[model samples]
Target chain A: MDFQLTDEQRALQETARKYAREVIRPKAAYYDETAQFPLDLIEKGFELGLLNLAVPAEYGGLGLSHLDGVIATEELAWGCAGVATSMIANDLALLPILIGGTDEQKRRFVTPFTKELKFASFGLTEPGAGSDVAGMSTTLRREGDHYVLNGQKQFITNGEHASQYTVFATTDRSKRHKGITCVVIEGRPKGMTVGKHENKMGQRASNTVTLTFEDVRVPVENRIGEEGEGFRIAMETLDNSRPLTAIVATGIARAAMEHAIDYAKQRQQFGRPIAEFQGIQFMLADMGMQIQAARLLTYQSAWMLDQGQKNTLVSSYAKSFAADMAMKVTTDAVQVFGGYGYMKEYPVEKLMRDAKLIQIYEGTSQVQRIVIARELLR
Target chain B: MKILVTAKRVEDPESKIKVKPDGTGIVQEGLKYKINPFDEIAVEEGLRLVAKHGGEVVVVSIGGKEVHEQLRHALAMGAHKAVWVNHTGPLDQMGVAGLLQKVVEKEKPDLVILGKQSIDDDQNQVGQYLAEWLGWGQATFASKAESFDSENEKNKVPALVVGADNKTVRVVREVDGGLATVECQLPAVVTTDLRLNQPRYASLPGIMKAKSKPIEELIPAGLGVDVTPKLTVTKMSAPPARKAGIKVPDVATLVEKLKTEAKVI
Candidate 1:
């Protein structure tokens, strides 16, 4: 298969990169320092059709190829991972509709946001469950034509500002993983409460807040799929989202490399630019090499998705490898910076901090390894 | 009615271009190319016209094989079809305009739209030349276009073109001082500026569909026109770099420097 991006994919990548460098980068530090959401950046991404890259064209969204989505994600993450996480979460929220929603559901829930700049959140991880989908305790009980959901979801990206959410809750507690079901919850619905924003160490520009559902009533038609299919739906969602995460990791790594390369050329040590030193040169080479490999894997996984191939294994591989590579590359980038890397004044420190979350969330590094191992064993 | 929209692939509008070591053009290595900013507006206007007036919007371009990429982009932006006239060597404004005129004669589109000027050259001369060759109405620097039934003929719908007004097409041109609304007739060419519609992103399905849409290539002979350069570039050079200026301690010192040293204030 050809690895070259189609013209549209290339254009989307360029647009995203332009937005990242010109708009997002300038405001990143301020958002990080103040722990505030980058609303302007988010709006700009919406305007550029970067916010909801997955919502179908039928729903008024740009409906980019999975590969295009990954490219855009990488570019946005390059600018600011926190902001990227917050913005890209809209895709995660809309994945259920893309995968299983009826035509009416897509129009009502997905189309409105595409007409404007709106944020969405995916509610899967509860206070007690991070990587354990079967362990979720939220419940959606049917009552008449509606379902009343009572649960608490934590660590939700864009939780505070999202207009809608894709919330998963157990419909039948006896069936474990099979008992879970997904539903759409309006942000301002009755009995829905948004908690205080979490003060994250990195990606501070993204708001991670806890959402409390107290008898939150949602239309029964809002169930994403048939009963007992929540686990499968969730896995499928990750199958699409994992590549996006890998893209974000790739962006972080690229940003680190760029910053390190520029720093090496400008910052002088011992009567010469540090970039002239073989030690630093090797480090830069290694970073570039790993970043390239990660990008290829990430794009390949996205391409597989576009081709309608089963990409669970490949996506897991990309997510695990790219996230780990990002962490290492950013850390090494800090090393390239030496003392300056430790200071916030330099951008590498921020890149280092931002790179950490890619390995933690969207199926932690350990979880990704588990998936890869399971697939390989199979 | 059939319409033709011309677009160019240039350095991304947001990017700051640096002149190449060879003085002929800007450095393109590692730079991203996009539909020329003004051309995007023109494409959007074409699509809007088609959507409202009910017609097909075809995009035409004259460049290297890479022009197909921009053609596909226009198609994904909702153009009905694409025609790319491939040129191996660079063409001056007059030569490119000649090629476009040939395509216009072949397609016989009711209207032609293009960017007021390409970002790279900024010559702003191709549309005028093509309009003159076609002997059709020309409207330059159009920000909007609307079609309504002419008051004189209640039964006939007249396209309310907005930008430049000439012998035929009435356009509302943005002058150095203010805006001037002028009327023009059909079979006209309209060039766009920045204030036109914000072009929509090509949706994934649109991109996929564009791959299937026919993009016919016409060589100079295929269009029954001889392709020859009308203008030659003997030499090219880079603009001189800005000289370093002294930095002041604060706003007051900068004001003093501007007033006394530079003598501008």
Candidate 2:
């Protein structure tokens, strides 16, 4: 029932907050403008132990708890959601291996990332299948000691730059979800090609592209689990990851609220500050309340996951609520600034743009609703 | 070169501070706290010194339990250990210096570094008082070659350089319109100025490592130091609010007001 963060968690939060304020926030607008992958900032974050947070201590990683990871994520997102997204994509990429990989597999694949500043992308979504997991057309075929992968994964974050990929494909498409399998592919093979970066609507600092694997030979040793297990593996990874996503949204909402509060108190109209008006005050109050509620839900879901509890329902609740709340709060922040908030010169409009993908990615708000309802019925 | 550095928990300058209704102190309700900025620099200097000279840095703070936050911050910045002087209630500059002297007598570090002034009170007296009371050589307002570039600060080249003999330290002090250099014998005290070094943010691993670092607690009474405030405040008050300025219609009116109404001319 206690709500206080442990002293170590508080120290970790402070460190992340300081790093975000001093390093990431200053360069956010620049990266967003050029849409360049912030390699330097990412390296700095890696050096600071801000990346690869969930990797086990045995592998030279921080081995931080889910609660600790979310606390750091929120502060980093408060600095810049786009940069934060790029940072956390590594954890998303590693979750599959962590959940299903053997000790040998973890040592071979995950340990290398801890020693260097390299990226590994989560390969799931395809051009044909966004929300429908079973609709993916990526196919895997066995060949003696290896598997041949043929697929096109679209909207793959860190795809162009990753040295490794944890990809999901089906051995038998007719069997749908039950037939899906996951494998780890190291580096680009002869038949594989990385597509040009996508000009995304928001979180543009994060590199997103298409990956085409044509007869890509992956070693059998790299397979995460038994055949027909990837659908659950991917779902579990999401369950473990959704709380982090929800906290990122909370961070964005918190950032937007702070900007709006500062602007409201200073913006003058009708011979006084706009903050003096009831309309603006009410908007701020609602924003503040919703941010707190979303944060509480997010922490609870993350805490439950850390405690080895089934959090499918609560994770969805947190993800959907926080994502929707971020979208609303950032938009309201823009509205609070009136015409000025729409301009590129101001920061709020960028936050408003950056918050859109949260509601749509990971699990869309609609998808989250479906999960919540199904869990309740079950 | 075993070094002792001070970390004083102070009100974050970013937090909006209000004097209490009774004028006893600031309103504590929504206030945030952080290690004093100058003290953070002093800790950084101690770390840099130990890194090159092959020794350890021990950070110490005097306050109630909450001061552990600042002590932990210093530890996370790479201090080897901490000594928390457990006490509460008000303490003036003399009281702080007396307590630190006792801790110094016990720890017996070869060197001590402190912030030139706490941001809250700007007393700027603790280092000097401790040095005088201890009968040790003192160097104050330590600075370095004037540069704010990140490159210069990346390696954290210390301003307080230890001599080749290992018994004396050279300090660059910021003085009026120029920098002065002085050499002090071992077991001396140094206070840090702003340009000593840019403090580093604690890395995640450093924060985790700090959790296991030991913090030994000692009460003022246990140290046989009397922490009675010799300097007492009669009252506290905020500065008067600024009045709005009237706009003059023209240069002639402005000149007339300056000459007559304001009577400055």
Best-matching candidate per TM-score = 2
CA shift of A168, model 2, Å: 0.3
Candidate RMSDs in Å, in order, are 7.0, 1.7
lDDT per residue for candidate 1 within B70-145, as digits (tens), equals 8988987789999888777767888788889999988988889899999987899999999999998787887533
* lDDT per residue as tens, model 2, B15-81: 9989988898889898989999999999999998889888899999999999999999999889999
RMSD of 1: 7.0
Point out the worst 10-residue segment of candidate 1 chain B by lDDT. B158-167
Tens digits of lDDT, candidate 2, A36-99: 9999998999988899988989877887999999999999999999899989998999999999
Please give, as one word, the docking class of candidate 2: high
The Cα local distance difference test for each model comes to 0.84, 0.93
Q: Is the docking of candidate 1 incorrect, acceptable, medium or high quality?
A: incorrect
Measured with C-alpha atoms, the lDDT of residue A336 in candidate 2 is 99
Candidate 1 local lDDT, A1-378, one digit each (tens): 677776667766756776788789999999999999888778767755677788767788655678878887888999999989988888899898778778888888898887887778999999998998798999989999999999899999998998899988999878889999989887689999999999888999999999999999999988888878888888999999999999889999999999999999999889999999999999999999999999999888989999999999999999999999999999999999999899999899998889999899989999999998999998
**Clash-forming residue pairs, model 2:** none
